[model samples]
Target: MPDADRPQELPARLLTDPEMINACRLRDFARVFRLVKTKAGIYPSMIARRCELTPSRVGEVIAGRRHLLHMDVIERIADGLRIPGHMLGLARRSWETPQALVVTEREAQQPSEPEETPSSLPGPDVDSILAVATRTSLSPATLEAFRSSIEDYWRRDNQHGGEPLRPAIVGQLRHVVELLKEDRPPSIQHGLYGIAAELARLTGWTYFDARQYNQARAYFTEALHLAKEIDDRQFMANVLACMSLQATYQDKPADSLALVTAAQDQARSAIGTTPRVLSMLSMREAFAHATLGSQARTHEAIKEAHRQFERIGQDDPDPAWVSYFDEPKLIVDTGIAHGRLGEAATAEPLIADALRREDHSNQRGRAFHAFWLARTQLDQGKLDQACHTATQALQPASAVASERVSGHLKEFYDQLAPHRQEPVALAFEARLREALPLVSGSTRP
Candidate 1:
């Protein structure tokens, strides 16, 4: 049994009964145990053996004993179960405390109206472009050809100046979503869902590029949910990976690690192999480790990432998001992770290689590369070079729209503040002051 006074190892329940009741009401203990079993697949006896606890104690925890206060034992159980600490913490807190409840007086409550029928849900606007594609005089083959043409056009235009096309594309996708909701034929609905997910992904990318991380998160979450409904595991994995990226940008490395871990599990369950998925997981792990200041783990993850990236071949890979996992991009991200870990000597060379490979066409990648290089230079005490590089990075920072990149720039500026009197430092300070407000929502002049 756990020691009552020492609750550090246990899951996050409070010492009092009210907290325990709340935790029990929320099924916190059960959830944690289940998650543990899910991750480690250990039987009760095996878990007890691994945790060095009596089998009876494990049983009690599984059975929800409110007085079991040995937090260390709980932590050991979590470790034995291979459950992440953050999740274990959530389980403990939820189990131990009554979540604040929203109360409404009976007099304040209004009588409920009749619920709307299924038919009341907004149906596709048949007058829209998708309607034209589905119900038009054009043949199915012609419609498909037209759709392909539009996709190609959008891709090309996006690389140039396609900002104006987004509204139209969003409208078309919304119509498709509506049609799916209205019980369109399964085949047609599936296709429409794919299109909608793609559109949502693009919108999320746009928001991410614009440094609107919260808005990007909403779009990505919607995309992931839609992908799951359609059983598109690959797309689901991509969406989860994107969420991990968003979490990292928000400076929540632990949450980022958890998201990526979940994403990796989802990706593994997907049919067939995906080098890109593996690579993404590897990169996220490496970056998370870097953020957490774990140098050895970061290197290990980067190695695994490179191994996965090496497995990609023209015919062996899923073409969907794999195209974005090219050598240069991978190197740039690796460099960024290393730089974050205070490895300027090692990181500088990688950043140099990445910059050499960077083409102006990839504005987003270029911006990120410049930012990483600037960061590396600053860390190496090359203030003049860092400031100049930061200025170049800031030029495209607004053009791409990534909160992660903006955050990096801000950190770089903060680091340079002690050297503010230097010309290069003053220049960086001025540019950062201008750009910071745009990305960070600060209105101070």
Candidate 2:
């Protein structure tokens, strides 16, 4: 834990041993009490009254000459002043042994650890990325770049992928939104809202990764509502796509299909006005169709998605949330959809490509990608690969606070049970068993 007494800098008040001794004297307690009373705007008599102690006893404590050592008195003083019990204890201890306070004061002035050098810190790449994002107007290319950057961040720290870091990131995004909400231009506010919606979507995805379906649903609902409020049809489509993902994970393929269709309708409505939005919706529609085993419809949807994707030149796409619809991600989703439909062979190459091109920063996406890969490998009888991929997926999934991903892992382990005689399968089963308590305890009531 970080030091509690150390402020950002050292204070100028230096305490000599004699001064410290004098400070610990019984009479000196009155001075301390008076200082606290003045700062808190309360009369010492009033404080004594509240503490159920006479003003004279309170004065005796302040004078450092009070012989009574009742713990209750100490507690009352701490409580009346609203000081933490631990701090109050420390103060009491210091009063008993004045040397301790002197030592503590000395220790507070010294640096306990080596100062971090600038070169040793992570570079300003994220700041640079944000700077670029802020400087440019919304375009398909820029949005894709932003998406790619976020994904790369996830991939770099595989351990943190899929964790509650999504909520933390949302907190940061919310800070930006708050700033934008304060006297920013309309255009800036518009962009900020889009980013907020995107962050909310990511929050939902993170929750889903953790297998917290209800929380995921709430976040997605919020994102969808925000997107609608912003009149950002593309963002709305993205939220819908996530809703489909949530439904699919919950074993509601039919509901997933409906969500995709809704997304597609919204996308089509924005086709002339927002081509990038159309492409995103089309991609989602293709995945939904594939998951539902609508082969011909899936193929047609993919074709349409490709057509729309092709129309979005780097310069032509919308600036917000448009960058996520890339060929690699689309192909990955295609493979996932195929894998769900029991076409492992057809899904393998696409999954491989997605894994290869996946951004490390997008922990949730990478976890899902790995999950689908593991499932496909299992289907193909590549137990070793399947186990390895599943383990990789779990590393990130564990860090994230998402119930959806945990459910996927639960399902994955369930499927692995038939092969429990194998060491890898057995090891995975053990891990899953251990995870059960954590999963059960972490759920929101």
Candidate 3:
């Protein structure tokens, strides 16, 4: 039915192959080229022709002699090959079929992942979805795609910080809002509302990280409204926890404690709640108590957090966002809570051990923890070691644009002012000046 010499659309088998997925995730183009050739029978020349690249360049890529990083080039490959944008860490592409139709149905211009999507594999056949007509309403597959995209958004935010990601996230959030305007079934509406709530909360988090308190509050309020619309208590707990943290940043520990209390209440009866969720809320409680200067309550909350963590079973399913709140994070948060309570001696080792165990791709986390480690060292009066540790932090900070990290550094610098004449402090000063000039919006938060 098709020309033997012609390059057919990539088979779904190749697209869904785990190896190919990993390669794409890593942006290993050389491996991608090889896979396309071996698995899809699309040779280098054909690949080049379809992707609008020179044959030699394609050959070089296949041979592992070249790499592709430019956005324009990446887009061309995606468009030319019909690769789903999520596969490439991109927003859904322009040519993707509308996810849902009103009264009239139309042919789909694209095929996407299935319900639950596997970061999932079992779904309708790719060719059928690629060639089949539209649905009257959004399907579970569509929701899965949205969830997948959101997961990627959070991953990128964790690794790279949120400022660079806000535009795409906001665009998707707006699209989800527009989708809500359509008359959908209650199931679909709730799903859409939950996603919208998450996006709003994430937007608020971005603003919070940037120290834009007013904007953060506005978006957080909007997220709460959306979460309430669906009676999604789990989601509500998550949002309240975010707000609780933000309140602490704003130096309102009493408000933080109240918010965390509400979060704990919501989480208690929330369906499908995981131990990690309970543990995280307790950590939030601990943070609030620490900020309030109640050492006894802080220790009690921290113990509760650990108790909840010990209850975490491997089979305990958590919300994707909660995945970040794992063992290393719990340890670091404990150290941080103690540090906030001015117990530097109790904090330093926990923070240091967690840092060593943290995932390297999480540059922002590394930077944040590194600052705390440095601060604890400084508080223990280890001037030279503290300066050295703080200097090391600049490596991760340089790789991400986070106002929180910058602000913490600024606070540390101010603390070092009395020691400015010392060589270690001067050396740290030179490095800081060279690395960031102290990004202007930085704050103690």
How well does each candidate superpose onto the true structure, as a TM-score?
A: 0.63, 0.55, 0.68
Candidate 2 local lDDT, 330-434, one digit each (tens):
789778767867889888888988889976666656767888889899999999889888877765565544455565676677778779799998777666565
> What's the ranking of the predictions by TM-score, best on top?
3, 1, 2
Per-residue lDDT tens digits for candidate 3, residues 188-207, read 89899888888888888877
Report backbone clashes per prediction: 13, 34, 1
Whole-model lDDT values for every prediction: 0.64, 0.62, 0.82
The weakest ten consecutive residues by lDDT in model 1 span 105-114
Question: Candidate 1 residues 1-445, lDDT tens each?
Answer: 3466332233322322354435433336554454445543556777678667788877787887632322344445545544333333312222132334212321111111123435744444533555556763323464365357446644543343334344565555555555554655566667666667766766566555455564466567667756776788777777777777777777888987888888788888888857867887789888888888999999999999999988887787574555667788799889988988999978988987988887776654676688789878878888888888878876566564344556666666678768879987777677777776544322322
Error of 3 at 130 (Å): 20
- Rank the candidate models, highest lDDT first: 3, 1, 2
The true-versus-predicted C-alpha distance at residue 236 of model 2, in Å, is 1.8
Candidate 2 error regions (>4 Å): 1-163, 166-196, 199-203, 271-276, 391-401, 427-445
